[model samples]
Target chain A: MHKKHNFGAGPCILPSSVMEQAAQAVINWGGMGLSILEVSHRSPEFEDVVLKTQLLVRELLSVPDHYSVLFLQGGASTQFAMVPMNFLSAGKKAAYLDTGYFAQKAIKEAKLFGEVELVASSKDKDYAYIPVGFNNDKHAAYLHCTSNNTIEGTEIFDFSTAGAPLICDMSSDIFSRKINITDFDLIYAGAQKNMGPAGMTLVIAKNEFLDQAKKEIPSMLDYRVFRDNMSMYNTPPVFSIYVAMLNLLWLKDQGGVSGIEQRNIEKAKLLYAEIDRNPLFYGTADVEHRSRMNVTFLAINKEVETGFLKFAADMGIVGIKGYRTVGGFRASLYNALPLSSVEVLVNAMASFEKIYSDKTVLELE
Target chain B: MHKKHNFGAGPCILPSSVMEQAAQAVINWGGMGLSILEVSHRSPEFEDVVLKTQLLVRELLSVPDHYSVLFLQGGASTQFAMVPMNFLSAGKKAAYLDTGYFAQKAIKEAKLFGEVELVASSKDKDYAYIPVGFNNDKHAAYLHCTSNNTIEGTEIFDFSTAGAPLICDMSSDIFSRKINITDFDLIYAGAQKNMGPAGMTLVIAKNEFLDQAKKEIPSMLDYRVFRDNMSMYNTPPVFSIYVAMLNLLWLKDQGGVSGIEQRNIEKAKLLYAEIDRNPLFYGTADVEHRSRMNVTFLAINKEVETGFLKFAADMGIVGIKGYRTVGGFRASLYNALPLSSVEVLVNAMASFEKIYSDKTVLELE
Candidate 1:
């Protein structure tokens, strides 16, 4: 097999070991002679799986006893509507921080339920920096923010809720960092990035906050329904949740979030350091707010960018293409992305610079 | 490994060959050196899988070109809210047939959107039979029904939508039989039963009916959004869809829906014949409305029922316990249940009757 480096943004890489175990379970689980996919979700075997999965999420996040960790469907896009549907009732306004594409998407969905207040926005500078500070509405339904911007590669480390309850979409950067679970009322993440696969969306909501859900919300869209039923209100994404459970086990083995966070920091440092020192490349996001998870940068010009991408592919490194809106390379260094992969990318960048760096290289043409 | 027979109502049995191939893809897809779960949905590999899956569904059911087939997240329960949210605006009514638990749940959600009319119901008999010969409102937004009742073991073979458009939740008996595509405006099914696994839901909607969707629906909940994007409007249930694709391929190899339906008929006939002939057990569903998918029945007493359950378990049969509300046995013989499995169940029932046929059998203690 070729040595491949997967840097795809969302449905990204997972630990190789986790993939192996998940594949095994896909064939036969618990020696029960049934694939995990073939077992009934209500059966004792699967119940153990769902319970173990939830327990792991709570343990990894150090989630409070009053909070419910739910494995749900519809991805973060569904939560974009569910959050506002549950919290932003008629006549209530939700305070939102418009950081990037996802935050803007959330804001649009929130607008459907009631009034929405844009507390702050980084759109003025193409979302290259996370807005430093904002005054939130203390009486608003809740304050919502996307903790990390995948496309722009910016992150907000500070999420001081002040007097208002906080709701966060940490889809891309969750589990790669540590945070106080008590600080937020609601947190949701699509599992493809840091958690597991594409189908399962994890929702951790404080119980009291869930009790405040608007009456008459559709049962499927209501957080209370999912939390009350232990995320079994309907048939869940079984394979996705099982895979996520394996990933959580892998996370715990890797010294939990703190241990992975340290490795992530080291990985980001190695890649960003190479970008800073390389003459042909320059970081895109603001240095202070650059996302450690997704490192976005440019390659001087289109010719250099195209040449480097082809070069990376030739070396069996793939999915390093830049976002459509932003014409620069983006290497998503997610939790499962090994430090060795980052070293390879950095070495590729250095080699490209060594061959192309010259005072009159373009003039020679 | 222990021999096991899975009769789960949903997340039920799939063809052995389909499960084998799906298990392989979970490890490495098409020798791409990436687990199907690890690849991006936008990748060419996953795109081909999704395309082939859709084509198979269309070909199996002979779906019209005007109808768009979608593989979405959130299951059929999400569609409960989405269907009415899109079709039933204020001042309009959606006529519903309350046949069982799911139909009631759908009605409850539709009530949140607009007026809901109970066109017919078998709830008086605890949904033990399908409601037949219902009058429908031609001017209503739509008429909705569940094609098969799993808990009650009833089915409606003739939908006959009248002049109004029909929406069906075919969660349990979707591919187990053949149907006319033009008879319904929309059809949705949770993949746990006859399709593949939990998490993914299939939606087939006529283009004109989709054009009538209400404006301002949440992007994730709107069918038009999924249809327009070819079910890639969001990160779908990738693993479940892939598995369902394999199951669909298996169905085609068995000669599509008509072939499977013939085997389904034979399987149900064998089981029902034993039920009918056995003096110690009896079927719950009315003969006229008996389902070919789920065969529900009961022993003469709780003692006999308990004894037979243990006997079935020892004989490698599982998930045959009846729903709590109904209580004795519900052998869900879905599309993948082999005729030999039905023969096994029939022999078990015969042996059970032979052992407990006498009136003094319970009194012998």
Candidate 2:
């Protein structure tokens, strides 16, 4: 089989070495003569897997002892509801940034629980860039923001809490970059993009912040329940967490988040440069706010857009299609996506450009 | 390597063929040249998987068109909250049958959203049997019950709604026996038992019943959202669902639920017969209400109990430990567990009984 370059967004690529090991573990985990799928979550072997994965997340992110790392299910979408259920009561207000599609979703769920004050919004500009210099309610229960917009191909490079507890949905760009854990009271990411697969959501939150959460909330939605029980309040997504541990081990060998960030930067720079030089194509989203993880771009016309997609597919370049709302192409350069895959995508663009340029000259004649 | 017999209560055994296919798909799914772990949930390939799995569930169970089958996250624990959040309001009372540990848990979450009336309970007898001959409130919003008590080793053989809609938590005994889908307004099972892995939950509910659910609930917790979106409101648990589809396929090959039910009966009879005949042990739950899925038993004495467990372990029979609250032994016979494995467990029991009987005679001498 030929090497296929995968760039799917969320449920995205993972290291080949990790995939190999994960496959083997599914068959016989730790030589226990049992498939990981069939192993009891309460078993010491799986418990160690959960513990080791949490430790790896802590070591990789430099998480403080004051914070708890939980591997929960229901993805970040569940976190959208859980964040409010835990902190915001009917009387209190929560501040949220309306930067893109996901941020708007977080705001929608928060509204179900309490008052939501929009701190800043880039919705007016189609979420092309992050908003700046907006004041947040210091007295609000918490200030929520999305660190990266998977759909709009924009990222938040800077964060401000404005005296409120900071909660960020870092779903798309979690392990792709480095950030200080102390700056935010809570951080969550669905483990598909940079972490592992789609079944688990990773949560890192301050223990003190959790203490103030409203009492008598649904236990499954309560972060305190998960924190107290070590995320074993129920049978967790065992295989997903196991695979995530393998991927995290791979990330650590590649020198952790800081190391992967450098490579991600290089890959993004290469792809964006080609988009700039290619006459047949133009990059979407503001250049200043362009995502290093998901690079959104468009062909000059609809004909070229259809033509180039087919041209690229023939070369085994898959999962570069953009989001539905944004009708162009999105090449997701998540952490596991190698520079070589980006080079293949860039070459596909260059070759398509040359063909289009010749056709345009002929049509002009 | 020896063939190990797995009798885990849940997250137990899966077909060996299903595990093999699942492991291969993790590396290269359907020869798509990409790991199933890395594929987009929106892609045609994965959409087909979700569709096919739904179809298999519908076909295997003969699900009616008025019902929707959903593959969701958060397990049945989440369903415990969602059931009341959707149907039960603060003023409305929901009737509950407190059968065992999991039934109590479901009742606890429901109380958070509305008033709960305990129609009947077996807790007075340490939940050794399912409650009987109790009348539920006909005017209650819904009647809730657990079909199987995983911890206490009891299963409900008969269901009655008392004119209200019926909802069941069938997490541990979902596919092990045939049940009329039309009998309940809703049925839910965490996939770890008879279905698949731990990351996904399977929900089957009547569309008409869901239409009456409360409006403006959090989208993720709303069954209507999953039904409308075909369980794709967000990225589903890809690998878990894939493995489930494989296991469901294996189940279909074994002649669907009715066929497996016969084998399950044989397996249960073999083990329960051994427990009844053996002088060193006695069954835990009431004889009539004893679960075919989980057969709980205890040794006559503590020293003999410890010795028998070690003896079973040495013979490569695993996951037979009972629940903490009900200390003894529990050999779970899920759908995928073969009768051959049960024979090994029975042989181990017989061999230990012989040794214990000889030791008793020697002590008397």
Candidate 3:
């Protein structure tokens, strides 16, 4: 098999062990003679799985006792509307931090419900850095922010919300680092990135936040409904949840979020250091606010960028092409991405730089 | 391995070959070292998968050219709200056929959008029969109905809709029978029972219906957004869609919808025959309206019902217990249930009835 180093932004790589476990469950779950996909979600087997998965999320994130972990569908995009649908009460405005692509999407959806206050924005610099030093309205219904911008490669590692309830969309960089779970009233992540396959969305919300949600919210979109039904308000994405459960088990085995954080740091550092040293490459996002999950850079020119893409592909490096809006290279070093893969990418960059160096110019031409 | 016969209501049984293919994709898809889970949704490989899956659905259902097939997340329950959210225009009420549990859920959500007229209902008879001979309001925006009630074990195999758009929720018996694609303006099904896993919902809507839908619908919940984006409005439930695609392939191999319909009829006939012959068993649904997918029945007595459950468990039957609201037994014979499994269930019923035949023996005990 021709193995490729996966660096896709989301719907990214997962641990082999987790994949194996998921595959096994697809055929015979715990030797029950029925595939996990075949079993009823309400059955005892799946009930245990759902509960155990919630517990793992709690243990890994050090989630407070009052918080509820729900495995939902529709990705983070659905949560954009659901957060406001549930929490943004009548006559109240929501405070939004316009970080990049996703935050803008959230703001657009929130506008359908109530007024939105743009507390801070990084669009002035093409979202090269996370916005800082903005005063938020304390009376706003909730403070919404994207924890990490996958497309722009900017992250908010340290940010303080005003008195309003903090609602974060951590889709792209969850479980790759440690964060105080109690700091936010609600934190949601699409499982495509550091969590699992693309299908399920993980929502960790405080009990009080859910209790205070509007009762008229659609049952499927209501956080309180999901929390009350244990994320089975309706037929959930069973296979997606099973794979997510396996991934969480793998994350726990990998020493939870704290243990994975150190490894992520090493991998990001290796790739960023090479980008800095290599003459052909330059970092796009501000170095201080650069995302550890997705490391974005640009080649000296479009021709060089195209050439480097071919070189990376030939080296079995996959999904490193930058997002369309950001035309460069994006090496997504998610939790499942090993340091060795980053080394291979770094080596590829070094080799390409050497071959295209100014000293060797015009030799072939 | 404990081999249990899965008769689950949903997240139900699937073909072994389909499960194997899905499991293999979890490891190496088309020998491309990356797991199907790892590939980006925008990647050419996944793009092909998504398009091919839509083609397969169209092919299997013989869906017309003017109808768009969408693989969406949030299940049919989400579609419950989305149906009215998009189709129910201002000042136009929707006509709902409240046949059973799921139908009521749909009505409840529809009420949130506009006035709903309950044209017909089976609630008076504990949803034992599909309501018939009722006049529908053709002037209403749309007529919404659940095609098959999974919990109630009743089906509308011969129902006529008003001149308005016919939106049917075919969650339980979709693809298990031959359905006339043009009869409904919109059809949605949760991909758990006869389709695949639970994460995805299959929506087949006439292109014109989508074009005329409310423009203000949320992107994720809007059928037009999904159609315009080819169901890639966001990161879709990837694994779920792939499995559904695989199941569609399997269905084609089993002779598409027609072949599966034949098998389904035979399985239901076999179980119902046993219920009729056995002294202990009596079907709960009206004889004329009994569902071919879900065959609900009850034992002669409460003690016998409890005893048979334990007996069925010892005989390796799983998920045969009726829905909580409707107590007894509900053998969900979905598309994947083999005639042999139904025969086994029939034999178990016969054996149980013989062992508990004497009515006077209970008093002696």
Kindly list the per-residue Cα lDDT of model 3 for residues B130-190, writing each as its tens digit. Answer: 8887777778889888999999999999755557789999999899988888899999999
Model 2: per-residue Cα lDDT over A1-365, one tens digit each:
88589988879999999999988988888788888999999999999999999999999999999999998998889999999999997678999989899998899999999899998999888999999888876789999999988889998888745578999999999988889999999999999888888999999999999899999998899999999998999999999999999999999999999999999999999999999999888987898889998999988899989999899999999988888989889999999889999999999999988888898899999
User: How good is the docking of model 1, by CAPRI class?
Assistant: medium
- How high is each candidate's TM-score? 0.98, 0.99, 0.97
Scoring only the A-chain of each prediction against the true A-chain gives TM-scores of: 0.97, 0.98, 0.98
**Pick by DockQ: 2 or 3, better one:** 2
For candidate 1, list the clashing residue pairs, or say none. B11-B192
- Per-residue lDDT of model 3, residues A274-336, tens digit only: 999988999999999999999999999987899989989999999999989889999999999
* Candidate achieving the largest TM-score: 2
Model 2, range B13-61, lDDT digits (tens) per residue?
9998988898898889889899999999999888999999999999999
DockQ agreement of candidate 3 with the native complex: 0.78
Over A125-200, each residue of candidate 1 has an lDDT whose tens digit, in order, gives: 9999988657876898899999989999998888776867999999999999998999899999999999998899
Question: Lowest lDDT 10-mer window, candidate 3 chain A?
Answer: A356-365
Model 2 ranges off by over 4 Å: none
For model 3, the superposed segments whose C-alpha errors exceed 4 Å read A362-365, B1-3, B358-365
